[model samples]
Structures are given as C-alpha cells and as structure tokens.
Target: MTAKFASLSCAAIIVAATHAFHPSALPSSSRRPATTTTTTTRLPMSFMADSSDYKADKSDFGDGADEDPDAAPAPLRGEVDMADVPVTEEIPVPMSRNNVGNRFLAVVLDGSFNKDDAKDAWEMHGDRIALTERHVMWARKQNLYNETFNLESRADVLWSHQLLSSDLQRAVGHAMCIDSPTIEDCREAISRDPIVRSLLGVDPETGMCDVSPVPLYRWRQIRDHTLRIDDGRDGLPNMVMAFDRPEAISDGLREEVSNDHLEYLIRSERVIAAGPLHVATPDKTDPRSIAIGTLLFFNAVDREDAIEFVENDPAARAGLYETMTVHRFNSLDVTGKFVSENLYFPGQNTYQMKEAMEHWGYPVDDLQTKWLNW
Candidate 1:
C-alpha cells in the first residue's frame, strides 16, 4: 500500500538510519579534480539504520543529495536531523576463494572508495521491493506447473505478468534461460557412449556436469534486507541466473545455437537483461565451455517462471550446462537514499571494469566481439 497521510502520511516520510563513512574512505566529489587516491579507511559500503523521527525543514539538509561534502555541520534545526551522505562505495566484491573458517560459504565484497570516478549507488527501495513481492507470488504458482523441467531450469513463461522497478527495467539485455528434463535422458545416452562423455564431460555417476554454486558476497539493508545493484548509470539489476556448460555438448554447436537463441529470447520478451560469458580474447576451441551467464529477467514473477526461462535456452537444449541457480542479486546494504553511483571500483577504467565483471560472471554479456577491442 502506498504510504498515505491525511495530507501526506508520516509513514511516507519515515527516517532511515545514518551511515558512517571512514573519513579516509569517503567518496570524492565527482565535480572536484583528483588524479590519485590518498586515503585508506575501512567502512562497509552500506549505511547504519535510524528510526528516530526528524523535525528539520527541507532547507536544512537539502534532501541529502546536495549536502556539502566539506560542511562541518548544519546549525542544529530542532530535535533530530539527518546527516550528509557521500558518494557510494565500490562494489562489495567477495574475497578470493580460500579456506578461512566458513570462508568457503562466505562472500565479502571489496568495500572501499578511494577513486575519483567512484560514487555511491542510487536508492529506490520503495520501488524495488514492490518488484520482489510480485516475484515471490509468481514463483509459487509456476513451481506448481513446472514439475516436468529440470530443477534448475528457469521457467520464465509461468507468470506472463511482470513487475519491474524503473531502474531494473532499463538494465535488462538479451538473456537465454535453460534447464530441462531430457538431461536425465541424455545421461542414459552418455553412459552408453564414451564419445559423448568425453565430448560433453558427462560424469557417468551424475548426468549433469553440475553448475557449481558460486557463493557470492550478498548485501542488504544495514537492517539486513537485500538490495539490488544498479550502477546508477545503467538500471539496477536485481536478479541473476547462473548456468555452466557441461562437457556433454560441443562448443561449436552451442555457439551456433546462441546466435539464434539470444535473438529468440529478445523477441520472446523473456529476458530483460541477459548475455553469455566470453573470454578476454575469443576462444579458438571448437566446442568451448561456457563458464557462466547471467539473466536479469522481465517476467520472473515466481521461481518456476524463472526456471522455465532457463530450461528453454538453446544452449541448455544443446546440453551446455551442468547446473544452474536463480536468486536476488543482493549487491549492497542501505539505510537512506544514496546520492552517487555505488556499483563501481575507483581507478578502474570502464574497459578494465567490464573485463573484471567476468570475475563475477557479468561481462557486459552482450556477446558483441567488437566491445572488447582495445
């Protein structure tokens, strides 16, 4: 329900907690000039939550967007007043693979802002959450009719109705979803054929090569609610579906199918944002293995809807993936409205950043070969 007041509900103006930035880590103002980083402070890119009511006039803080980065503090208004917000932090990239404690299952994002280009992420909590709620409902219904597909298949068509936040909608690109039941049948076929196993890398024991579950550094509200990452330039991408190619299928066939497959997805309106994984340089291998791909869906009203979409990808049809998973793209914690772009790393050029996203399986997956040209 929309927050309403007799005129404007107090609920509409609910206060968020203030986030503390290590002075050294505060994002540099975009309007200023700075070529090198000169500080090292540790503060989670997210903010702290506060519920105390605010009584300040709008003129006091200027809605937090235009707050002076150098201002000592505004003259106290009355009771409680919100503080200033700085640029968004760098992406919270998880720590590298290791074996420290529960490190195997834990993910830690690189949370620092020492670059001039780096800024905070935008906040549209009210809008994004509405998208999530509608999705949960869509998933429940599709899961009922989707028993026939592989557990990991993204059932996109289940709920034809889609709800998306404006930011989320803009970031979606071509996507292919796949997971299928024939995989079991393929398992039987491979067991009887050695050529198939080696070509497809099918384990005789398990037919699917297995989509390794890539644990991620997920973020949420300082109060523990999840958030979607929107580079602020592009829309906020809130969902991701990850799938890997099994050795069962040849790379040659998979690539051939993807040309048609991606086109089909876009025409079908199945994907909002989607793309395939590629190497820094084109792979010369005949049948290349697709490390992974991500899809920010448009019609994923439910889990089964998401599964249906994945199950239908042409690559999946060609036996490309071993496993797959779909879930919220939890990228950062939030308290108040963020004023700057928070989804990037400082000092990293867009070219380098695009390549680095492959580390998280998000290389501007459009499959355009020319974009990689130096």
Candidate 2:
C-alpha cells in the first residue's frame, strides 16, 4: 500500500485554524508577496454526483460531445494493462479485497531502527500476523478464482518542515482540485497564504514555528480508500505492516532509506519494510518527531515474485535484517473520498472543468467557452 497525502476537506479545519492564529509563522513574504483573497468557486451540479453513480465510457473523453475540435486527444482511461506496455517483465495487476471479496489486513513497521529489530516486532504482533495470513489466504483464493493478486510494502520517511505547514496542506487540496506543477509547488503556494501561516503558528522571520498537530503525518500513511490494485483479484493482496518506535528501527537508518530508496519502493509493485524514523526533530514547542518507516503490501503473484527477488538479492541475503514482527490492522480511513467521487475528474466536456481551472488561477477561456458555451 502506498502512503496517500491528505485531502483538502480533511485539512480544511487545520489550515483555517493555523492561519487564524499564526500570522507570523508563514513563509517569507519576500519570496512571494501575498495576494488579495478571491471568492470560492462552485462546481457544476451535473457532475457533482457521488462515485456510486459514476458511469464512465471507455472512450478517451467520456461521451466526447463537449470536446473542443482542436484540443489534443485525452489519455487512455483507467489503468493500463502491464502486458500492453513495454517493460523488462510483465507487470501483473494487483489483487485485493476491493477487487475480490476477501478482507485486507495491514501491518505497519517502524523503519528508523535496525531492520532486524523492526521485523521482530511485526512478527510478535498478532494483528500483524493475522494480516499476513489474510494476504496469503486472499492470494490462494484468487488463484482458485482464476484471478491475480498483487502485494506490496512501503516506508514513509519524507517529512519536510516546508511541507508540514497548514498553508501548504490547503494548497495541496486546491492543487488536486485545479492544476499545479507538483504537489510540492501547491504546498509552497499555501505556505504563502497569510491566513494559513497565522493558523499554523509560523515564525515568518525564521520560517519555522510550532504548527498544530493535525495528525497529518498519521493521516498520510492511512488515507485513500481506493487501494492501488495491480490486478483484478478484488482481494488477492491484503496485508500491510508499518513499523514505528520501540520496534528497533533507528532515526538515522530511516533517513538514509528516505534519502535513498523509499520513494521508489513506494511507487513499485512490492511490499516494503522499514521504519520508526522521525519526520520532525523533537523541540521545545512540539516535542514529537513524526515517526518514519512503514510497510505496504498487496495480494498478487508478483508480490511473491518480488519477495523472491529480494531474498535472492545479495544485500537482503546478507542477514542485514535482525528482528521482525507483524501487527494486524483494521481498515485505514485515508481521505480520498473526493477522488472516489464521480465528480472527481471533470473532463473537457463539462463546465466543472472550466470552473476548476479558473479557480486555480488558470486562464480557462478556451475550455470555458467551448464546453460550457460561456
């Protein structure tokens, strides 16, 4: 399972509160001057229905009636078949509870300490054990069902202070709503918001201050309801283990992984192991450092293949890992409700697309006039 960033609605109260109190805590105005506020943009009613009602056609643009003749063709819809794409090997789709009917169990580990110790903790945790069993069972069932399952693991150790600001949080939300170069840029924009800075208690001079603990770090690891399925097994891959403190992973080790290999693992189709690394340093105002290190898994044959690959690797075979354990987990309530909504993606045909673009400060005259007939 990949870690998901928080959604705008989940961070709205945090951003609002941060801006209200910590005016000086925002980023340096010298970097980018603050601007006047604008009215909130509302989406069109036609496209705002819940995801259950969503019925997208298999075309590049759903029902392409609203597409502009000159606009470039839209990209393919849904996930691409790995077989169809070029790669060193065939990437099998991940199977999980959402794909099949089996339940998913996750075990998160702390990756900041010794890899051996972290592994030990997961093994002792019964819940984690259960989760692993669930994954195996789900995978077996998928095989019987003539389906595929994908299992993967991950570690989340990248906790930048700049990204923690409430303004940045809100900007991320808005970015997902509109368009932005990167999530980091969206965060930078939010950092510029005076209101957001005030609320987060940012010290403008030093560009550092005690921001409210909104569990943003915690939320990031377990938001997003839709698990990234590698195949269509529904429940082939179903376990995850995230390791944190007291589990033996050290801060320094996790940082090394974060700065080196974690992000790549998060984006790959394998289970990840490592954790208890800190997101922030313990300080006077806020003593808690965001614990880094986590594991994400799916139920796919490829999962076992990846594990085999790791076990066969000289690095993993060298007994680098010391202790290991597992903890079973219930469902993670990550916030991706918006993405799951039918209105989540406003195609070129809808007025909602224009509204969203304009809201993001983009010039949407072409899209607006063409599709919305504005």
lDDT value, residue 169 of candidate 1:
26
Per-model TM-score on C-alpha atoms: 0.26, 0.24
lDDT of 2 by residue, 201-223 (tens): 47768896332332222212333
Listing every candidate in turn, what is its Cα RMSD in Å to the true structure after a full C-alpha superposition? 25.3, 23.1
67 Cα displacement, candidate 1 (Å): 39
The lDDT of each candidate is: 0.30, 0.29
- Model 1 gets an lDDT of 0.30
- Candidate 2's displacement at residue 355, Å, is 41
Q: Write the per-residue lDDT of candidate 1 for residues 125-180, one digit (tens) a residue.
A: 33233344333333332232212222232222111112222223221111111111
Backbone clash numbers for all candidates listed: 60, 93
Q: Candidate 2: which stretches are off by over 4 Å?
A: 1-235, 242-251, 270-285, 290-292, 302-322, 325-374
> Which candidate achieves the best TM-score against the true structure?
1
> By lDDT, who's the top model here?
1
Residue-level error in angstroms, candidate 2, position 369: 37
Error of 2 at 265 (Å): 1.6
